[model samples]
Target: MSIRRRLGTTLVASASAAVSLLSAGQALADDFSYNPPGTLVSGSGSGRFDETIYAPGMRFPIEEAPAFLNSQVWGHGGGSGPGGSQCDVENFSYPWWDNYCETRSWDMPLCPSGQGHQGQDIRAKSCEKNVHWVVAAEAGSVTNIGSYSVYITAADGTRYDYLHMGSVQVSVGQDVEKGQHIGKVSNEFGGTPTTVHMHFNLRQNVAGVGNVYVPPYLSLVTSYQALIGPPVEPAVGSLDEVSCDAIRGWTQSPSSPEAPIDVRLYFDGGPDTAIGHPFLADLSREDLCTAIGSCEHAFQVPPPLSLYDGVDHVVHATASDGSSNAPEVANSPMTMNCAFELPSGVRRRVADLDSANAWHFSPFWDEIAVSDGILSTIDEGEDLDRTPRLVATSSAPETLYLVDGGWRRAVSDEIVGVAWQFHPMGAEIISDEELAALPAGKPLRARPIVLRSASGDLWLVDDAPGPGSTGPGGLGGSGDDGDGATPDGDGDDVSGSCDCVVGRAPASSAWTTVFAAFVAAGVARRRLARGRRGTRP
Candidate 1:
């Protein structure tokens, strides 16, 4: 046999042994049966009872069925009518009396038209004198009480309907204990004459839609077995935890590849035990770094991946025993990649500006790089100062342009910094003509910007770099002069109309020479600054 199959067999054997040991001395009870109106039967009745009688933690509704005939006549397990006719065998349907027997031609079964009775009919002697008291099978509130029906809602949200009731004694909203009398059974309506019986029915609402009938007998049997039996144990198996680390990479795309983190668990138990129970793994890139020195591990998960960033997810596994459990759970940290560059020469990234909002943004970003003053302020412009103005942007239509921040035109700048308040996009360098057409408070062609706060509140900032200044230039540049020409070199002015320079070095030697020159210049400037400070002192 295969190893997995052998392991499964062993687990099953072990669990079965445990259950047998636990229930060794206890005897399972037989299902309850009503004595027909007339019959005589005898048996040794020595077989393991498979029928269930009660649910766990639930009580029987009534101590006993109410007396319908004289006490002696009721207790004999059967009854006889006038002239020595067998009453129990007379009116009782086939299958109840004799499995092979067929209904008499003159008699009508409960399901005469073949509609098939949805509920079982427990026959009563008479509708008037018997006074069949209806009781609740479990402790529940009387959710609905009417003359013809009484509905009891159990703690587990199951509703029991005792329909065709003569008159309800319980009122709506009444708290009823288990076995409390709610009403009396009567077949005064909804069935043919001489077929008086309590129509017990069970209906379950599927997904908040309509109700479907489930046999009451089946529910009763299952519930009864659960109550009397030992608690079912859950199965156990292998548990796995997976995670990913996203670090800065060579790619210009928003996503960057980092390290893989994984942990595996081996278990020896039942497989089904893990259902509904969450398996948790708390992992952080920092933790992995501390443990392994490098946050890299073998990939237990297959490629063409789905999850990104920090690695926390719930996992389900089947055990050797035909059972299953969720053995692995992972939680990833909130991360954001600011590698997205827009047409306006701006870059955008998300950050969990507030620690309190960590839960809100954790699902989207892979890594959150922390720095001082990543958040910016709101610039509502001078115009909307008196009015409560809010800025909002749609990620669609354009990658980072502002949609509305009380501005007429779209923001033509890339987002530079983001915070809970205002996020500063790139600076808007407008000409004197564009600035002059502003209506005092409102600037013409205002750069539209939207800012979202930790509280989910949105604001609009127009014509202002709300907080942080421009981002650092390309590697060769220092401050604003990086875009200037490189004298005595083949470096041409690649700066676009926006005054931003894009430089390209020769495939072989240009980058090396340029880098060395910048380094030398930086060292000389540092010495000069230190000398100036010392002279001042």
Candidate 2:
């Protein structure tokens, strides 16, 4: 006889026995009960009892038997016996067991060793011809798809395994919609009555058994919900500049070579509500670099200068709280400036300039004090003689000619004032020929190059040539001028007298008188020369 016929006969026999037991007043009050409920029964012997004999309302949980069968299928406890005795249950019964037996040693004879069946089996009736199609319970990415079995893992980490399938319809990594057909039920195991049925099981942690087994029904429900859930949206927010003080005590050392210079949105903005908490968002160094317009996050300012000199940066913060009511916070633009060096070796002032000090460095003229006899304002103003000076504007390769003689160049440790370097009118540029034609070594006094005004012009003054012609000696005119008196090489007595008086006799001596007389004479000559130069027009 076919397997289906055998299953049909078994069901009929069980039903008849159940009806007879009720008539005889031997029926139990439980939903489903066994003859001697807790005792084990043998598969081949007369230990078999009809399932329907216990209760009128109780019926097999599954409508049909599993299409696949295995002899090694046994209860949680190890057991073995004839005609797949493992199918029989004992005193302690779970909702899943179809039959019970007394001998713990009764194991399913059909299943192969080392491949023990993990799920339960149902009895199939011969008249039930259609094998139920296995379907996915939840929505998720199909992690593993196979011809005989298919497995899916939900985003929440739950896993579902479907075994004994004929043809898997989906491929690995495919996103499966809920309730999709995986495959049709196939063959059974061992030499049991060749019944057409399906065995279902739920396993957790495919990695190991420390994972608990959930009921097949429960798993199906959960998988169904996972596949149908709505998609998640990304959160948004603002990033703000952080004070150095906030990170002064940070313990985790940054792996990057650049020190931590910027406060990220993750660090500056509070927590993201979408993710459910505040996190140092996993941002790549490239992202931060693009945001800051710098090569590295941790930048080093020149010694003593704590201020940052760079473009203003804006950080974007996202809300973490799931509430739609929360608004995104954005940080105001933070401007960095060059830092100042302190007297002590400790570099302190390297920080963002306060709002009050964010003025742009004009390419025009401004008066600045000289420190240690060195001119400090080179780009902003011309030399004292009103000549145009060439100021190095930017590090980029573009050449900026001195318009109206005002150009500034940042020289080593000082802003060297340029003069007499005017951009010729109607000429878009000043060529190398023109630059060379101008004074080579002489300082060119220049009028501050102004689009509109010319207040900060610089003038190139003629100073005597020689070792003593530059710096303190050249400027103070203390060196000898070939003649015995103070050096008056430029014929200017005002600067020469001061130099002459130093290292000389007191005010009352003959040398003092001689020096005064000579200085007065030199002053008259200088005034005449200057007047001539001024009136040359």
Q: Which structure among the candidates has the greatest TM-score?
A: 1
How would you encode candidate 2's per-residue C-alpha lDDT over 168-217 as one tens digit per residue? 57778887654576655444333333333455554454332345333333
RMSD of 1: 24.8
Global CA lDDT computed for model 2? 0.29
Cα lDDT computed for each candidate against the true fold: 0.30, 0.29
Best by lDDT: 1
How would you encode candidate 1's per-residue C-alpha lDDT over 433-493 as one tens digit per residue?
3322321211112111223345543333223323112321232112121211121122221
> Model 1 shows how many backbone clashes?
32
Q: State in Å the error of residue 23, model 1.
A: 36
TM-score of 1: 0.28
How do the predictions measure up, each by TM-score?
Answer: 0.28, 0.25
lDDT of 2 at 18: 34
- Root-mean-square deviation of each candidate, in angstroms? 24.8, 31.9
Backbone clashes in candidate 2 total 95
Q: CA shift at 56, candidate 1, in angstroms? A: 6.9
